[model samples]
Target: MASPARPEQNRVVGIALRLCAATCFSFMAASIKLGYRHGVSTPELGFYRFAFGLPPLILWIAWSRNWTAWRTARPLAHVRRAVIGLSTMLMGFSALAYLPLAESTTIGFAAPLFAVALSALVLKEPVGIHRWSAVAIGFAGVLIVMRPAGSQLPALGLALATGAAFGVGIVTITIRQIGRTEGTQTTVLWFTCLSVLALGTLLPVYGRAHDATTWAILFALGTAGGLGQLFLTSSLRYAPVSVVVPFDYFQLLWAVLLGWLIFADHAPATTWAGAAVIIASGLYTLYREHKLGRDRPKADAPL
Candidate 1:
């Protein structure tokens, strides 16, 4: 019999998987932008993301021999999550079409801020002064990044990005409720399968022939998304959320680099400054939640 891995080794493995997941997701976002540039419609991209993503997840289920993950007692809960999750995906992909990747990515950092408020209001979770203060400062950071007055960013993009974040906030709360009775694999598997089914209905309207390059981009987008989901799921298996969640922020850095390299995009000083503030606020919120022994809400990687 093999000895069990030590805690330190497990943590190191978790962090590595977390970082890899971040990279895959970052690359996935870049692919979304690239696919848009290649004349792939937002809805088409959305459909492909879930359709292609489902295969790898199914493979993972088979490999793990976790057939129970496919059997959920909460059908209505899965439907509800799928509805919200699919809408969030379309809004996020549309936002990428309107905003630079880096800016879109920065706006995404606000999801946790929205989650805090949603938890307090919807979940009626206890919110002390510290978490509330963190939420306030985090919104301030979002404002800084938006620079609403004399802002060059597109209004549609800002609205879509912000809406997506808000949707994520609601999803976070919903996940907490479902998570009490459901395993992560069940939640993820049902959401992905349902999303693929729901989005497939739109194909007759938005689907079109694309060049080989565009097809390749779509394929890569779904594959990376599936792989990222796997890595993220596995990371939690190896280490606690507190150990790996912080590395999720590394996706922003990857976004910046990819945006610059591929799109000749340069994020402004305000964007960087705001990202720092938002990240700090988020980190502090996590710290306070852990300190208070509250269940820290998890932010799923963006589609």
Candidate 2:
């Protein structure tokens, strides 16, 4: 039998891990933007990012010696996830090129709200009124962030970022469905492999890295992305979704700090206000889902 305090300890560690994941992902976004500034196109940056990440993932697999994990009964399912995942990466990186990091990160908070809507419309999953209300409020928050009338950010950038969030939501759904029969390693490995292949094809037209420093940055970008994903996946293994999901909000803090420190970019007051609304709505939706017994660990797929 386990001690009473064991669960609490796990929850604490899980929250810490989740926070670490958030920080790593924030830095990854910053690196992507940095790479863009150095003339790396989105496709090239994304390809190298996944390509460099392969070594670490391969090493982890070798260490675990789970060769069977590499074999999956549902190859097509993995391909589907990879396609959606690639779309998410393209939209996300493209958004980073056009928008400030903090704003892009804040807009990403809409992912869970999108998940709620997608679940209802596509999955035919039951969502109660409270969750629906939260979703509506969350979209309103997005509009506030957009502030179309006087917004300085390009409309295309906002659309791309929002689309990225929705793409993440779709990925989340696929992850949940695929997770029923697949392990984390399988899902991640397949996605990385597929993304590399898909993104690699565009290298002939868009790829360019002229210096050692640029090459190093591209490698670091991929490493950070891979490690951040590992950290997020590990966190859920230790604690329930309800315990660590909220800590994902920490990404906003890291984003704000990184944007200010690295790029001297500051989000306007409106962005912060909208972020608060989105955060509240996301938390409440999670709460309502948990309360209604509709929440599951699979629902905590990383954005």
For each candidate, the alpha-carbon lDDT, in order, equals 0.85, 0.84
Question: Highest lDDT, which number?
Answer: 1
Q: Compared with the true structure, what per-residue lDDT tens digits does model 1 show for residues 1-303?
A: 222233353889989999999999999999999998898898788888878888888887777767788778899998998888889888999999989888888889899889889989988889999999999999999999898989999999999999998888878888888888987768898888788787788889988988888899999999999999888877876787778888989999998999999999999999999999999999999888878876343535536
* Model 1's TM-score against the true structure: 0.94
> What's the lDDT for candidate 2?
0.84
Candidate 2 Cα misplacement greater than 4 A, ranges: 1-9, 299-303
Off by over 4 Å in 1: 1-9, 295-302
Model 2 C-alpha RMSD vs. true structure (Å) is 3.4
User: lDDT of model 1 at residue 255?
Assistant: 89
Q: What residue pairs clash in candidate 1, if any at all?
A: none
**Superposition TM-score, candidate 2 onto the true structure:** 0.93
